[model samples]
Target: MPCWFTLTCAVLSIFAFVCVLGSEVNVQRKNLLGLGSLQSVAVSGRLICLGRPAADVKVKLYESEVLLDSKLDEGRTDSNGVFRLSGSKREFTTIDPKLNVYHKCNYNGLCDKKFSIRILVDYVSSGSEAEKTFDIGTLNLANEYSGQTTDCIN
Candidate 1:
C-alpha cells in the first residue's frame, strides 16, 4: 500500500476505537447515577389532619431502635403535606426503616408541646434493581399523634 493510504487507515482505526470507548464511559456514568446495581429505598407519604393537608410537619427516618442524629434523614412536608425521603446503600442487606413525625395539629404559635408519631416499617430490600421506591401511604397526624414525647425537633 502507498504511504498516504497506510497513514489514513491508521487514523481511521484510532478514531473508531475512541468512539467505542467514549460510549462505554457514558454507560458507566449512567449506572453511577442510580441507574445500575446500587440498592435504594424511598419513603413517601402525605401528612393530613382534620381532613386537610398539614404543611411544614417535620418528618425523619432512622434505623429501628437507633436514635442518633448523625444517621437520621430528615425532611419537611410540602404545602400540600406531601413528603418523600429516600436513601441508598451499596450492600444488598435488608433494612428496617423507621419514621418519626412531629406536628401540632390544633395549636398556634409553635405550641410549647408538639405531638409525635413513630412508625416502624417492615424490613425492605432493593432486590436486583438500582433503586426501589416504597410508598408508606398517607399519615393522618391528628389521629396518630397519641400525644407522644416532644424530642423530635431537638
Candidate 2:
C-alpha cells in the first residue's frame, strides 16, 4: 500500500477531509521536523465480536499528528482473534499513539465501525524499540464507546 493511505487526516467540524501534501510523500521527511530520539510502543490483544472470535479485523497503530497521522504498523486479526503490533516514531515531544480498531462486529452495515484507544504516555519508551508490551486484554465489540465512528474506508 502507498504511504499516504496510512496518514489519516482528522475530521473537521463538518467532517470534511483535509490533507497537506507536498512534492514528497514519505515518512522520513515527517520525522526530520523532530530531532528527538526514537520512541516505541508494543501492544497485544484479542478481539471478540458478540460472543465469538472476530477474525480478520483490521488493526492499526499510529502516532497521531495534527495534519498527517503516521501509521507505525497495520495488520489484521488472526483466526484466533489475536493480534500483536509494535512500532516507533521520533518526535521532539512525547509521542501520542493511538490504536484504531476497524471491525464489522455483529452489525450488517455499509461500513466498518471504527474506535480508537489512546495509548497512555506512561507506556511509551525511548529507544529504537519498545522495552515493554502493553496488554490491552480482550475487547468486546458489542458495546458502543465515545468517539466511535463509521469508517467506509480503512
Candidate 3:
C-alpha cells in the first residue's frame, strides 16, 4: 500500500479503538458508582414569592450520583404555589435525592434563579415508586437563601 494511505488507515484504526475504549470505561464508571436497581422518592412543598403564590415555577427532582446526576421528575407549581413531585432512579446503592427550585422571585433576569435542597437518604424507598411523600414545608423566596445560583438550562 502507498505510505500515505497506510498512515491514514492506522490513524483511523487508533481513533476507532479509542472510541470503543472510552465507551467501555464510561459503562464501568457507572457500574462502580452503582446507578442500577430501582429506588424512588417523593417530595412536596409550597413556594411563595413576595407574599404571593409562586405560580408557574419549575421544580425538578434529581438523583445525585457520583459520575453524573440524573433528573428523575419535574413539575411546575400550581396557582396556589404547591408542588408534588415523585420520581425513581435505578441504583445499586441508596440514592442521593434533591429538589431544585427554579424561580424568578425577587429577580428580573433570564432563565431562573436556582435554589436546591437535599432530601434525606432515608426518604428513598426500596421500590419502583415512593411509599410516602416528604413535605419540605413552605418557602418564601423573597428572602435570599445561601448557595443560590443562576441556571439558564433546566
The lDDT values for all models are: 0.63, 0.85, 0.90
Give a tens-digit lDDT track for model 2, residues 6-106: 45433342244223334234445766876567899988899998879989999999999988899999999999899998999888689998899998887
Ranking by TM-score: 2, 3, 1
Off by over 4 Å in 2: 1-30
**Where does candidate 3 have its weakest 10-residue lDDT segment?**
27-36
Model 1 lDDT per residue over 33-113, tens place = 756544445677898888899998887765443344323468989999999876544322344555667777754444333
lDDT of 2 at 43: 83
Off by over 4 Å in 1: 1-39, 65-72, 89-93, 107-123, 126-130, 145-147
Q: What is the lDDT of residue 77 in candidate 1?
A: 96
Model 2: weakest 10-residue lDDT segment is 13-22
lDDT of 3 by residue, 1-154 (tens): 8999999999999999999999978876886787577789999999999889999999999989777789999999999999999998766678899999998898999978998899997789988889988899999988887899999988
Q: Find the candidate with the highest TM-score and give its number.
A: 2
